[model samples]
Target: MNKNQPTRPDGTRDFSPEVMAKRNYILQTIRAVYQRYGFLPLETPAMENLDVLTGKYGDEGDQLIFKILNSGDFLKDLPADAVTSMGSKKMASKIAGKALRYDLTVPFARYVVMNRGTLTFPFKRYQIQPVWRGDRPQKGRYREFYQCDADVVGTDSLLCEAEIILMINEVLGKLGVQNFQVKINHRQILNGIAEAIGAMDKFSDICVGIDKLDKIGLDKVMQELADRGVSGESIAQLKPILAFEGNLQEKLTYLTTLFENSPNGQKGLADMRAITQMLNSFAQAKDFPTDLHIDFDLTLARGLSYYTGAIFEVKVEGVQVGSISGGGRYDDLTGAFGVPDLPGVGFSFGIDRLYDALEELNLFPAEATVATQILMIGFDEASFAYCLPYLYELRQAGFATELYPTVEKKIKKPMSYANNRGIPFAVLAGSDEMQVGEFSVKNMLSGEQQRVKAGELKTFFATK
Candidate 1:
């Protein structure tokens, strides 16, 4: 092995058996929730055209993107002068035209645009896949991680947003997360600040600054905004909203007055009002958790500039990390791909952070291990062969079955292996049982033993 190559980067982790079982259960439950709402599964390649990703996420997101190196001596045509002068971006453009996808949303937009003819309208998809980034890894932040996303394309209905909000609520409930709040904002509301203060030209810069609100606090956010050329008047306009402390209604009334002149801002406020109305309807029907409330801080700017409408961020009360899941509506993501007007709204559950939240909250279910249900203990050479049919029969009956493949390890070794693996059942087949048309069914958990007819092996596990 090459020592210099090393194993994995910081901020990333490998999931062992027990951890993965818990993660898998979380994913499966979320997937079930997505499907019940008629969302279909979709997948895109892990890498995509560099141009497809670059400008979509603004500057900081571009910095986080992991660019893949070109293969097969493709960089042989390197111009020495350009190489020296242009550095990474210029050189990369010539040699590397593709990159590992930074997030599922962009690639999904590309997919929808390319396959628009083949798919139906209101395309709903759930993608659970790993994404690569080059960001500095810290606790709950990985260089590579999975995103479980559900999105609806081709419409901008407020009901879609409502359904997704409830969907998020349902999955979190099922995952056993009790104390959490879904903080929501709209990009248009964010845009309102820029519009209100005439900093609309530097919208991206404003967003990048404000996205750090949770991380840097209000004074730093305002300082960052000012540093980015936002006028003093603009910063002051943001003060009351950022400092506003009240329920959603109180904040909304203040925000409406503040953004009264801005058409886009008022539209965002209307959308929020409609969403609140929908939430009230759900509450009347008893479908939502009472604690799920919107916090409308002017500072809640999601970093992505493509978010054209309602944006979401989920967080727990006492945790110090970033948002566990976030997303929003993008009206022109498809337009970038030449498929105009295909609006899409979606949310991504940050697998790494969500895991951290559950771990911190001590909400993970009692671990169900990956142990085999039956370990066919091979007493001798013929015993394994004899138990092979019984193993196959038991497996066909839906039990996870494995065989102790080596005889050099004695009965004690296999039993110890079963114990280490948390295996509950062992089919102890000896020459005597083979001849007698029976096998000893050992229950590793209860330490009970019983004889089972060969034909009844399948029935035993089936009923079990």
Candidate 2:
């Protein structure tokens, strides 16, 4: 092994059994809920053609794509100018023509485009897979991690947004999340605000600042907006939206006045009204994890250039990890794939962040720590012979039981192995105990051993 190889690459990890148990629990729950919504499972290759991925996620995102270099004598015919631009834009295409996919959506678009002649419309699929990015590793951002995603393509129905939110509520609710909140915003609404404030042409720049409102806070965000060439009158018209509050409708009332002459603003307000109503009809606080709320804030702009419709972010209470799940509608997401007007909306459940949340809440059951239900003990040579059948019986009865492989080790030695593995129960078949048609069952947790008959072994573990 290379000395440089570490336990995990930077921005990556190796989950222990304890962590994997909790993580798998979260994933299984998400899978069940996603299937309930009728999303079929789909998976794409871990890597995709560089042309398929480049320019899809913006310049920064393109940089984050983990490009695979040309293999076997890669530099033999490289152009001098191409060699000069190593690690720059031109060289990326010449030397690295493919990349580890940054997200599932782009690849899905490419797949649909390539297979357009043979597929059905409104394809709904769920993909749970590892995606890679070159992002700086931190507490919640990992370069490689599984994103449990579900998306529906070929429809622009607001009903889909409602359903997506409903799915989010169901997944988190089943995962024992009760204090998190889902922050909802529309790209149209954000654009509307820019138009109303006479900064329509500067919508992109305005969005960059507003999206940072939470990260840098209001004061710094305002300074950033001013630096972007926003005028005092425009800023004044934007202030009320930046500070709007009350119920969903009240927020819309204020927006109506602010965007009185802006037609696009009118459409955005109408879309928000319909989406909020749809969400309310299905997602009730009594049934959902976090109470759903919609507010008018110029600062909720999602940073993606592709999000042309509704967008959202989720935060769980008492958890320090950033948005555990987030996504939005992309009307022309498949446009680059030559399938324009195929609107799609979806969300990604960041399994790692949710793992952190579950950890913070201590929601996993106590029994989740064990990798096996029973550990067969090595009492003596005769005991090992007598215990083999019992081990098979335990295995057949749906308990994961393992026998100690080496007969050379003393009983204490193997027992220590069981303890180290967190195996809770142990079966001992000593010579005397074997002849009596009963075995000693040890509760490793309590160190209490009891004589249990062979016939009753399965029954004994039923409750556990």
Candidate 3:
């Protein structure tokens, strides 16, 4: 790459108009589903006070937050002698006071804490915005990408968790995702496994390692735990739990016995049972089919320490990408900010990953990419002038209508533009047709042409 050449930053992308259309299609589908579930829209600033985001997502997540340098001479505050010798950690603390949010959930907790008095109870809100991270980029991952999230706070109902499962299915179903699985587990259950194995003090370390199980494999995860100071004896006890296999009921029964002396484990098991029962009733009432794709995995730890209860991860089959969506229940996320005991549950759809999955499966509908519905072409100046009012009328009637900017002697130029844009219809008119107060409407797909009076263009497209 030339040094002087303009380029997008690595791990970011410039979306073409066509790509934007497809992305908007996905966003609209998600927004619609969120609205149907009674979630209102919300937005937060791109940068937050660094402290607000720092300790919320656990150590691994905290490291990925994109910090913003202080404005003007950032090093002025450092002592002259210490500036040259300060450690990286100390320098970072002194120089950066703001950072891009790592995710929506933490900032949301802060928001609830700040605005608790003015907000309604059990507030349900949805946010669609771009979040920045310092993560390594890959096929489905990016340094900057949009997260479409819907969350409900101020309630501890397991019904919220069940409804989230239903919304996950509905969003994917509407987006034409054919095969996907929503993997769910409870943080309490993970905690129980830690307790039963006698590694309760190292729970967070264990979670951070187990969360990498799918990516790093079991042997590597055990090694990571040992590196994090987990005992060999605890690892031995945890192996069978991590490798537990059975149907959902059997998994629940297995946990019931393992959690006999663990309160967190028992509560987690009861929550799972209540959530699943509500899900069945909700599905039956809504006439939503059950595919049994929602699975219970003993090793499913979501790494984020904030997730206190149910956690979810949605994976699409046949796509070489990571989970397209994930979130969990946070009973006291707001407590850190002085608002205690507010329980909330939510999930976010990784729009970029979902876009990748849909593209891989060729699931995007033809209409999703269509921008202009009709392009009007003129053989000469008079016909072109005549198209101006019809353009206004067609647009007034809710058609995406465009008239060629100038008359061209060669007909192929305008036709080619329409074809390249996937415009389905074209109106062709010459001096003769304009003189008769009529236009030629051509179906670009069938190449079929019809002559209609100027007053009838709207009605003509109305049928289409």
Mind giving the per-residue lDDT tens digits that candidate 2 earns over 423-460? 89988877778789888889999999899997888899
TM-score winner between 1 and 2, please give it. 2
For candidate 1, the 10 contiguous residues with the lowest summed lDDT are: 286-295
Which RMSD does model 1 reach against the true structure?
Answer: 3.0
**For candidate 3, what is the TM-score?**
0.91
How does each model score on TM-score? 0.88, 0.93, 0.91
Residue clash pairs of candidate 2: none
lDDT of each residue in 309-387, candidate 3, tens digit only? 9999999999987899999998886888887888889999989988888998999998777789999998988788888
- Model 3: residues with Cα > 4 Å off, grouped in runs: 1-4, 57-63, 69-82, 85-97
For model 3, the run of ten residues with the poorest summed lDDT: 283-292
Task: Give candidate 1 misplaced runs (Cα > 4 Å).
Answer: 1-6, 9-12, 79-82, 85-87, 193-206, 229-237, 283-298, 367-370, 453-455, 459-464
Instruction: Give the per-residue lDDT digits (tens) of candidate 1, residues 106-187.
Output: 8998888788889998889999999988888766667888999999998888988888788878888888887777888888
**Backbone clashes under 3 angstroms, per model:** 0, 0, 0
Top lDDT model: 3
